[model samples]
Target: MFARSLPIISLLSIISLRSVSAVDYSETYVGCVSGTGTSGALASPNVNTISDCNYACADAGYTYAYFQYQSAGSYCSCKNVGPSASEITPAVSGNTNCGGAAAGVNALATDYYYNNCYNSPTAEDTTSQSTFDACFERCTTYTNAFVSPAGNVYSCVCSNTASTGTAQNCGVSGTYFAYAHTATSSPSIVERRKRRLSERLKREEQTRLNRFCPAGLEACVIPGLDDSFECIDTSSELESCGGCLYGSTGNSNASTGIDCSTLPGASFGGTTCSAGRCEISACKEGYNLVEGRCDWHV
Candidate 1:
């Protein structure tokens, strides 16, 4: 009798272990549930339904699971432990009856939702859909719960009506511009013009920097003016004008070089740098520069 009882106890222990190992498919919840880091976790792509999520978790030997809502579908995440009682929202339940419901026609402006991925191409819609209304309508046609007009394009994304997904943790402020959802709102003309102008200015600056100059010379912008730049020969421009005027020190005397004012006895006038050296291009009326000095001629 004692030996038979020992076998029965062992069998009971085996049954208990099996029960503990079984995955609980019904313990789903919202939020980014996890331990300190990714310690007992598995992620599954294209998990559209709860069953898919649970199956993926079970296959990966995890006991708990959750979904990440996105345009493509719900991505599944499997974990070893269920969310804490504090982490679970029992009142709000999963959409067991997703029912593939089409978007309603009477959707309100606030109902038009979107996730902020970033201010890059992911944030803006660069498509031909010109207005937020058009983009939202496109979303409704395909059961997409969110429409975003960012990056100057229209984008429609799938969403889980069950829960609001985690907001993106964009590091920068203001760069993450808001998405367009207004029915009457079209793409921002002002924004488009600003972008075009910025690109044009960049190109123009590059062209100026590439202007032809003698060897050892480079192009630079003039000081105090937008659109004013020149190829500079630092070795010869007036010592003050040497190098790029944009940032070169304007000191007139540097022992090795001389500004227009410090040219021997010649008065400051038409003086220019030819390669990396200075030359008197012209003289004031009634004055001629001779032997590094200016003389008045009758």
Candidate 2:
């Protein structure tokens, strides 16, 4: 009885080992699912749903899988089961071959276009519809015909034979179309002109001020004169006025025989000399004459 039991146990152990060895660790196409895009190879062992294809492929030991449709439509799912952790790279296809090994190729192409090409306004408007139709038509034309510099990949071109004539008709309208173009152009030109005018006015004002003040010289308007006088010019009688004044100094300097250069200790007034000339004979308190010149006492 012991010898018979030993044979049975050994046979059962052999059968279990065979079953474990039979499991294929290779990548495979699981089933149909949804995805979008047009370039790059897809991984295997995938089933289609509006789910995360990246996670699915990674879970199945695949580097990546391609999705074919933006909506809920037929798609290909793949996974990589290559030994030694090698990635399964597939050939780029114009259409998704959903049933077999080509299942996720179309989805990959759609993703490539939308992410890379459709980001720009010119590319997006031109290729969005074309890309959609090309995916539908890829079941037949698997040729590597068109390549986008922006997308950095090859893709299928959809037939635009119908809409070409209509686009030409729209370009030929009337005066309204001309007016629209003019309207856009005029504002930019006007803004440039206004900026130039403002700059010119500022430059002219600076030039006039520089002529009279001539850098590094303090300038003062002469009392009772329309012109300004520079302190650098000793010949100008206005500079002899005790201190600088900003505007027309109304006859105050001429009426008082006070030589501005001789004012003992003068302070700036709002617009005229007030209490620094000793020739006035009488002055307000906190003032006194020193050597025939008015000076502040305190």
Candidate 3:
């Protein structure tokens, strides 16, 4: 039985290898990042969607990006450093529906949570923030931000500057929450996603082409054929090549592929076709082709 299962096991192994990618981004979602140290913040109101925000952050040279909803639509904040363990609340996916005042935390605009300070002395501030989203946005402005609730007032404060340092137990007397921003994205994952997206687009294009062209012939256009498509064997056709383009002139007849041998300067020129394209390696020694015209080599 073990011998019979060898091939099955090997096939499964190959399938698993093919399926592996960077990581499951959905599983990695960490609520809403609120507090961060006092640095590495690039904020923009235009960015929407988590992927777009992550890409923008990566482009801005940040390793982590955070998305949050505010009064002004949605905003994305980029930062290099990640939140600390102490700052992160455990498994808080959305704003906790404060079952009355006992719960203390208010309902965010939508629902947001992150690795942040929860009624800790680490984030003590004088500026008053009315809502959690406001406090979150305020924290993003600085490298580190924390929210402390004194009675009904929520004060947003900065805990540290730079990527280094630790949170202090300062806001013990008041209900407070602190959060730090951490880099949740990496260049490798971005590249993988891009590659997958590109492959999907290519597959979609090919599927569309399949609907139009017969077997063996791919949907393509000949050189000089603008806005026109033809079914041609790119593997053997001398014109369409891997794509289409008669060369710099773009003056090839759409119905028939270019005949390099028929050209004046290319006469007696040893032209060969490879991979569905034609190429003239050399013009008969004394011949030259220049400026859309071919002539004898000077």
Q: Who wins the TM-score comparison?
A: 3
Native-to-model Cα distance after best TM-score fit, residue 162 in candidate 1, in Å: 12
lDDT of 1 by residue, 1-298 (tens): 0000011111111012222222222222222322212234556455565555544443334434555445554455555443331231111222121122111011111223333333333322223344434544443323223333334443444322222344433212222212333333213422342344344445544544565555566555555665554665666667534555454222212233336545544556667665555676556667887754566877
If scored against the real structure, what TM-score would every candidate get?
0.21, 0.16, 0.32
| lDDT of model 2 at position 158 | 31
Cα lDDT tens digits for candidate 3, 122-187: 443447866544565555434455565544555667655432244333334343454554223223
Worst 10 residues of 1 by lDDT: 1-10
List runs of model 3 lying over 4 Å from the truth: 1-24, 28-181, 184-195, 221-228, 246-264, 268-298
Residue 199, model 3, lDDT:
51
Q: By summed lDDT, which 10 consecutive residues of candidate 3 come out lowest?
A: 1-10
Pick by lDDT: which candidate is best?
3
Give the lDDT ranking, best first. Answer: 3, 1, 2
Candidate lDDT scores, in order, read: 0.38, 0.29, 0.43
TM-score of 3: 0.32
